[model samples]
Target: MPPALLVQATAVELLALYRSRSASPVEALRAVLAHVERHGAPLNAFALLDEERALEAARASEARWARGEPVGRLDGVPVSVKDLLLTRGWPTRRGSRTVDAAGPWTEDAPAVARLREHGAVLFGKTTTSEFGLKGLGDSPLTGITRNAWDPRRTPGGSSAGAVTAVAAGFGPLAVGTDGGGSIRVPSAFSGVVGCKPTFGRVPAHPASVVGVPPHVGPIARTVGDAALLLSVLSGPDDRDPFRAPPPREDALYLGALVAVDAPGASDALDPSGALDARFLRRVRVGVSATLGYVDLPGDTRACFDAAVALLRRLGAEVEEVAPPFADPGGVLRTLFAARAAHTVRELGPEQRALLDPAVQSAAAQGEALSAVAYLEAERQRAELALAMAVFHRRFDLLVTPTSAGAAPLIDGGALPPSFAAPFSLTRQPAISVPMGLTSAGLPLGLQIVGRHFEEALVLRAALAIERESAPLRAPPLRAS
Candidate 1:
């Protein structure tokens, strides 16, 4: 079997590839490794690659397939893990040179370990923002990760390279961590699906999470692929004390997605088939151009309006609504600052000086937060979460622009703190689905915010929009 013929490949496709013997698992791993090696420098999507180790794993998987031995669902698919997560073979540098590569990392982070147990071929690590601190991709250790569609624009960050790798077809699935829009922002910016499952859904405790924020999730080109990856990655890890108990059996996401996919399920499942019920005419949605005060560009608002209208056509009720709580950003700023200070303040002075200027500046400000301020931020966070809960009770979902504008240039300033950070602060699950492209040809995205952990509904509504928007096939990258 030839490596070049891997079809409209996704996690599902790759699983099928292994199931049918047209291509051996080793051949698929080789295809992915070769693809990444040829394109890695151009996209800067990966921070490291373990070709020999990955190939060995694939060979073993091939042997299992040949013997009719049962294996985990992801058995031979090559997937990328973001550099921020701990993996045995790669330097989990968090996009910073401050951490020494020779130090302890004898085992995988729980999510990483799960993928390995499931037979996922962990071929390499993707780039991340320094300590996963910023939204844009440039970092001291690995430099910048270019957008797959247009290199000049930012891929959107912390998970920048994870989405880029998947977008560029270096690999079909990549694990991405999100704090303040890290996963969804990049996924939206790069024209892919980014799922930041309800906080703690995929338990992780990277060196960056001292402030009690941040999550590890999946980024893929489609919702089903994201679900497939999330199923493998989600579960409690003993190391993270904050990890939530395993969710109720009935609400397990992947199972819910399948249950939602049943036929003739209007009123039980929406058209996209993940929600518990079909979209009713006039299902109220609170539309916000800005989550109240953030200025929005006209084009961004227009695109959002178009998306809202489409929802209406699908029988959703759209209304303009705002959370009762105001100026939650101040609280978030305090929380993030204190957390950042705790996580990075101990870095060697020289290393601190070398950090991204924005991160350094933010950390300094964070260090200045008083204990009183941190306490208040926690209060505000709780209040904001309650406010969102009330808002959702009144309206089915909240619709907002995923970004203030279209994907910004690669070197442009970070996006304003608005729609994304608030939800991140509240711990409500949100998904950024590709809307349409801006006149400039960059993809525009709309965020759908659901009640806490109601990811199935969010995914269902997102798939509905995805079906209506019909993402354009990003033409292959000139055959690598």
Candidate 2:
């Protein structure tokens, strides 16, 4: 395959290329590095690129592939991680000028360590919002991470760089964290697949300052790729107090992917990449266009309705449903602000000066909350979770727009409320898959939410939708 095509290959496709000797890991890694270097500047999607380390690992993977002794599931595949996570040798600046760049960067975050263990060619760290505090991409440190679809637009952030990098073919897969909508919002905006596995399904160390609401997840062009990476990232890690127990013997992430493509799977279980509609039949899917709070925009509503209709046509038992609980927006805001306050309080005056004003404002809001108010928010959260738990008793899945609309212009209105904050509050597994693009060509993601630990079902359902929807096209850089 040509180097150009190599840069666009999916993780599964790249693995096949390595196994067949059609492409070496070094060749693939170099191709990606070049592509990212050439086209990545406009989007400013990368925080740091470790070319030497990535190439060295790629060479070793090439040797292993030559001997038919691949190290693990993601052997030879180049992957990017959001900078919020630790990387043993790289500074995790978290897109904050306040973070020191000096020595003492040690230990990989659990997810990063797992990527290394799985033989992934760890390459780069993507940009993120300051402490992942805001919704749009620009941070005082990394500047703006423009949407790949149109450099003028915002790639709905905190995981801004991760989603843009994945969408632009910087790498086939990226590790992203969602505290609120970090992963899914950016994925929805950038036209990539993003999944926030049930809280703790993928462990994180030094627990997120945002508390139990944040989750580490995967970003990719295909649901199968995300599931493959999730399998590697999901497992017991003693460092995370919030880690989920060992995955049930019956509920593996990749098993879901394989089942989603059963008749097409081979001994190698190579992801077919082609969409299959065999899944989702008889699956009870509940649809909530607005979650009964935010006013749904006309364009996004039309797009979402079309996608939901398609789900019904695919044999899903679909039902229109009212919001299960009262609007939790205020509760979410309180929890979010309180966490921001906790994080900001630890910073010294000098470091605080470097923080984004939005972060400061959010922290200030948090600081004003009395202990009683904070507890009230927590109480509301408990009630909201219970509401969803009971509501799911009747529906196998919940579908909503990942974001209220397409990526907004960088200088225009903010990306509308994703209606995603509520599900994040529930700590259930949810995925954002590209359903289609707006008439103007921007991507729109359809979100699928599932019960706790039901990641496999989420992925299976998303894969079916992905297989049936019109595939999103590459950005202009590679456009025909």
Candidate 3:
């Protein structure tokens, strides 16, 4: 197959081709590397590209396929890790110059370890905001990661590089960490699919200081590909004290479990994959345009209304509902500020000077927080979680616009408003899927949120939307 078509293929498609000898891992890696080299710099998508090691791994995968002895689920697929996740052989700078790229970079984060174990070729580490502390992609370490659709715009972040890479066809699979809107924000702006699974669903080693709000999950071109990646990403890791093992039956039959099970069903309603529409029949979806406080830009509101119309046509009973709680931006900022302060407490003056101004400001705010204030924020978070739990009991899913606006200019003043932070605070599973493009041709995303530990239901709903929505067009990359 030609490199253009090969680069655009999904992970599932690549696997089938590899097994049939119609395409090889080496070919895929070369195409991806070439694509990255030609367009990656413009987007600032990667912090480090391990070209030599990627080629070596790809060659070995090709040999395994030649012998018909592929190692594991993702045997020959090329995967990228967000710089926030440690990769054994790569320096995980975490989008900060304060982190020394030296020895003792000896361990992989749980997600990366799992991918390595599954025989995935780890080709590169993508960029992020300094310590992933901001919603926009610009960092002191890697500068700005731009939107794939238009280089002049910011690709929403802290999972900025991961989304840009996926949208630009540099790779089919990427692991993105979301705390606040990190993953889904960029996914929305980049016009790709990103899932922030229930907290602890995908284990985190050296757990984030930001607490339970941070989740590690998949960002991909399609929901099915994200599901395939999540199957490997989920499960317990001893390193993460909060990690919980998904139910055995769900893990064993992921594909079937996600496709036909009814909302809150105890038993599989249909395991034959023939009940796609029925899966959503009478499903109660609560639509909150602003989640009661976010300011919706005109374009995003129009796109979200269109998405509601689409869901109605798909057999879901959609209603406009007020979110149960007021905006929790204050609670989120308090916790995040404390976390940011802890992350940089030990930095020397020289190292501190290298930090992003936003990171510095957040740390200062955290330093000024009183013990009582911190405790109050925690209490509020617990209350918010309880409120969402109650809301979920009445509704099968919550639908909202992923961001308040389309991708903003790279030089625009602030990060676009997003509804993603509340779900992060609640530790619920939420996904951002492309709804449609704006008049300017930039993408918009519709978010589907489910209760904690309900990823299967969330993925099923996202897949239904994917099926009914217009297919996503490839970005007009200069390299392509």
Candidate 4:
């Protein structure tokens, strides 16, 4: 097979190849290893590429397949993980030099365990910002992660390496964490699909704190891949206090799309995957380019307006709706800072020095927040959540530009845009779909959001738009 073919195949396609015996799972693993070594110079996406571990797993999977034994859905497929998540054999530095490489990691995170149970071949660990504190994938510990589309541009962050690996085909899918658009920002900038499932919808213990809205999510090239990954990751766990009860309807999210347009689906008693035609026929969509406050890029407004027009053209009722709450960013910052301060309060001065400047600054701010100020911020968070609840009651879906604009060049540092943090605050399920390309050839993305825990609707709406929009192609890996 051509190297370019390896670059373009999706997780679903790889599964089909394995099932049909067209390619041995071990051979597929080798393809991933070869590509990683070949593209490492240009992509700079990986923190560690475990060739021996991945190939061994792949060979074992192939053996299981030969024996006609049961295997996990993702069996034999190579996948990368964000460095923020711990893996037993691999040293998880989380892009921070302060972390001791020899620290014990005897247990897998719930999501990591699920991936292993599903037979995913863990290819390697991708880079991350120190403690995932910043948007751009740059840290003093790990060098900057550049965009695959343009080596000069950023791949987006704090899930920077995960996004870059997907774009560069180090793997077909990646597991990422989103505290404040860590998953969505990179997905938007890197021209991949990013899914932030409703908070507590996935098992994310060993990472979650008291009330923070951090979530474990999937970053992939297509909605199907994202859904497949989500399925593998979503479930209850004893370790996580916030693990939500399993959805009443346990269906494959990727398969949900196939049933979306089927006859009688709209009228079906179960509304899980089916769209309400009456509702969708003239879907009420609220579009906001600037979210009523933040400044947006010139092209951001244009592309968003264009997307709104496209939705209207598709027979949806599109209008500009002011968000119900005010100044979510301020509240979010306070809450984040407070959480950061508490989480890292135990680190010694020497360990703290190794943290990113942004992380340190946030930690300091968090430490200084008075109880009254923190409570006020908490109040604002509740108010914002209610406001979103009311907003979605009126509109079937909310639409906005995924990022303020295209991915920035990885130089000093690329910051996360205002659009992502608010939704994280709201804990609404958001999907970042590639909308179009800018004249500069950078990918522009559109974000579709749904009510809390309404990933079905969010994915359906995104798929509808994706069906109409041009697919985002992977950038060719070439020498810089």
- Residue-pair clashes per prediction, in order, are 4, 1, 0, 0
lDDT of 4 at 80: 89
TM-score of 2: 0.95
Error of 1 at 369 (Å): 1.7
lDDT of 1 by residue, 164-235 (tens): 898887778999887778988888788888887788777775523455478788887777677778778877
Question: Quick one: ranking by lDDT, best first?
Answer: 3, 2, 4, 1
User: Using Cα atoms with residue i matched to residue i, what is each candidate's TM-score against the true structure?
Assistant: 0.90, 0.95, 0.95, 0.92
Evaluated at residue 164, the lDDT of candidate 3 is: 95
Tens-digit per-residue lDDT, 164-263, candidate 2: 9999989999999888888998899998999998988889887763533579999999888888899999988999988989787523666555334433
What is residue 88's positional error in candidate 3, in angstroms? Answer: 0.3
> What is the lDDT of every predicted structure here?
0.76, 0.86, 0.86, 0.79
Which model is ahead, 1 or 2, in terms of lDDT? 2
* Model 1 deviation from the true structure expressed as Cα RMSD, one decimal place: 3.6
The alpha-carbon deviation from the true structure for residue 55 of candidate 3, after best TM-score superposition, in angstroms, is: 1.2
RMSD of each candidate? Answer: 3.6, 2.6, 3.7, 3.4
TM-score of predicted structure 3: 0.95
Model 4: per-residue Cα lDDT at residue 36: 77
Runs off by more than 4 Å, candidate 2: 209-212, 258-278, 478-480
Candidate 3 Cα outliers beyond 4 Å, as residue runs? 209-213, 250-253, 256-275
Q: Find the 10 residues in a row with the least total lDDT in model 3.
A: 256-265
Give lDDT tens digits, candidate 4, residues 400-446.
88788788766654554658778888888898988877778788888
Tally clashes: model 4. 0
